[model samples]
Target chain A: MWPGPADPVQDLIDNFADLDSLVRVYPLLLQGFGLTILLSIVTLPIATASGLAVAVAYSTAGTGVRRMLVVAIDILRAFPVLVLLVLIFYGLPFLGLRLNAFAAAVLAIALNNTGYFGEIFRAGIEAVPPGQGEAAAALGLHRMRVLIHVILPQAIRKVTAPLASNALELVKTTSIASLVSLPELLRSARVAQEQTYNPTPLVAASLLFFALLWPFARWVARLERRALATGH
Target chain B: MDRIAENYFNGAVIAAALPAVLRGFGITVLVSLSTIVVGISAGLGLALLRCAAIRPLDIAIAIYVDLFRTLPQLVILVFLYFGMPYLGVTLSPFVTVVLGLGAVLAAFSAEIIWSAILALPPGQWDAARALGLRPVPLLFLVVLPQAVRLATPLITNRAIAITKGTALGTAVSLPETLGSAQSAMAIMANPSPLTLAAALYLLFFIPLVALSRVLERRVARAG
Candidate 1:
């Protein structure tokens, strides 16, 4: 099914002969990978909070805020993350101050994630029993306090796997960091590809991505099974 | 940044890219539409396969769905772009993009449509069969309509996903909205209308998807 790359199997061996060069770029790649994790971690919290808030606003509030949030969420959800990334990353500098590549990437992703997270949180919170909210209200708890102490905890558990899955998507999406001259995994691979004149580095970097993502994918799978079994 | 603005919307370049981008958008629409067509049919077939009593077919669809679901869209795009060209097989950017989108969406779409199918209680299928509803009209007239109605909201989400995934066509230089903008910016050395280009993308997508959601809710409610 494939042609021999000289020396029979040795061509396969030789294709990746530049593996050692990755050692130098490894730290750089690790930094990029670290930044990806940082992006996801940073996004996970802020988006979760805001998404819950947005969801709450819509679920409870009048037509004005609900309609605004609906339109906002719809637009953000429909647009590709990269498109927004380009807009935010480049658009912000035009406004005066500028974030570095990593900050911009993180911010762009976080902004995109916030809409999604908001919907997820909204759904999770909505899944909570109405009686629970009523009880919390009956206890003289403020809406904010009730949300914080009563509703959010259970909703958080309901939405954990989804948020984690979104985190996994963030891992792959972070690969776009290469475009912005970020020293992420994909960018290092591109650099190594140029330096060694081989595709091995790119493949290695992809493998690195897969290695990073597989655990989360598996975890999500397990969580899905649990959710199913529990009849969530 | 200042110099980049000078060439932002060069009439000549935008004109050159316009035909190409329009053609690319056509291809995008074609791909998205075809993916919907093929993905829906194939997805439904797979869903039916899993629902069938035979373990072999059920197992086969399960693995097929799993394999396609687990693979990344980028990998599939790269493979179709780079891999098939070597085997005396060539495809236009249009076909490749459509096929790639179809391949990715089919797996998830199948499961989504299947869940919708499952939601109807097994009694529906039994009821159809008991009424002497054979496969064709039973599916075309009876089952799929209801399933489609049930799946409307989720399908809208898939529609948005498919549209976003089509942006990947820019990678192969198909001159879609993003590709034209990249070329425009690259030649002009200006990134201003990259803003405009981004705006145009949001312009194209935001309303289209919003309307689709409205349609989804309407269908969902009607169903």
Candidate 2:
């Protein structure tokens, strides 16, 4: 749901185009920026872990388990991250599960990422020639060992570029936590926007977002270049 | 007993959601259609410029691609949507999102199309020039057609990018499927409608994802 039209930041800017008011909100914006990064950092590992588990479950689950996992992942992928955050943060309390807005937003977004990333990892595993997997099995490698040794190294390499892009997506998504008043980057900017009536200050945070993502893209490109150079 | 009751509630919510959900579907379809159209045109223009023999122009377009492709769409939308209003440039949320997202899609598509263009046999361009097809017509008719053949799957992926990208709409409070669902759920006491909303989104996303995959295979076959 949209925020109420308090527009505190906008008001601040409207009342004074002075750099002073904008500067005053700098700390708030910084806090938001810090929180946004923290959320993404925390969410990434959780998402990757959950995603790995789900991928395993999808691969190893019996027909019934696989079907259930597929349906769950399908639903998760289809569900909007923002809407789910709202539901979990606001609606779940009535169901006796309670998380504050920050926790709820992170949980929801991380859960959403898990579905797609799980599928990505699953696809990565599937892309490994079955012969390799069979060879591992013949060597007496347990399924777990086979996966750890033969599949994951290659899969991690395969997914690195997409995972980098996914990280960019997750960074943008943490902004939605603002909707439930999580005091994130956008939330801080929204606050400043209402207070100052000037969104130019938000331009700073946007630049930071761009700054944070640009390196990841370059890193992915660098990885691709190295892979091509090595002909791997 | 609880299962029966829950199913009945779900049925009612589904019935209620049918019209609005269809409207949501309509919006997504339109967004997808317009995005592909506008996106491809911009993408083509960009790819042509970037892949042009002119070094300066190529560098400029490369920078554009890098800037937009690297950043997340929501952050850009926020800048366009909430940031522009203070400058006395007001756009409705829907327009803000569509254009903002269309720009990002164009940025990525340009790279995909440019690579596809580069992949074509240089002989094709040579033959076109020999036929006196001239620069513009040759690029449009001979060059782009082949580029489209190669770019089709990537373009479809761009389409999925835009489709999934609409989730960013919720960031700007656009009443798309997810937004409408959230507001509706807020008003309703039960989660049944949220459940329905999730189902409807799958009905949209799954097909798009699957179609892109199929299209990718087809393009590979054609290639």
Most lDDT-accurate candidate: 2
lDDT of 1 by residue, B46-144 (tens): 776665558887777766665555544654565466445434367777778777778667776776677666566677778889999987677677777
The sequence of per-residue lDDT tens digits that candidate 2 reaches over residues B169-197 is: 76776767766666655655556666666
Q: What is candidate 2's CAPRI-style docking category based on DockQ?
A: acceptable
Each model's DockQ score: 0.25, 0.40
RMSD of each: 5.1, 6.0
Candidate 2 ranges beyond 4 A from true positions: A1-21, A61-68, A221-232, B1-25, B119-138, B141-143, B171-173, B215-223
* lDDT by residue for model 1 (A1-232), tens: 5665655465555455446656546666676567656666766676666766788777778878878887788777766777677666664554555778777777776677777777667767767889999998998999988988999898889778666766666656665555567777666666666676555665566566667666677676566445433434
> Could you give candidate 2's per-residue lDDT for residues A1-232 as a string of tens digits?
6444467665545543547766778898888889989998998889988988998878777899887887677667766686578668765765667898878987998989898788667766665678888899999999989989987887777666556666666776787787788888877877887776666567766767778778877776555334322322
Clashes of 1: 2
TM-score of each: 0.76, 0.83
Q: Model 1 Cα displacement at B20 (Å)?
A: 6.6
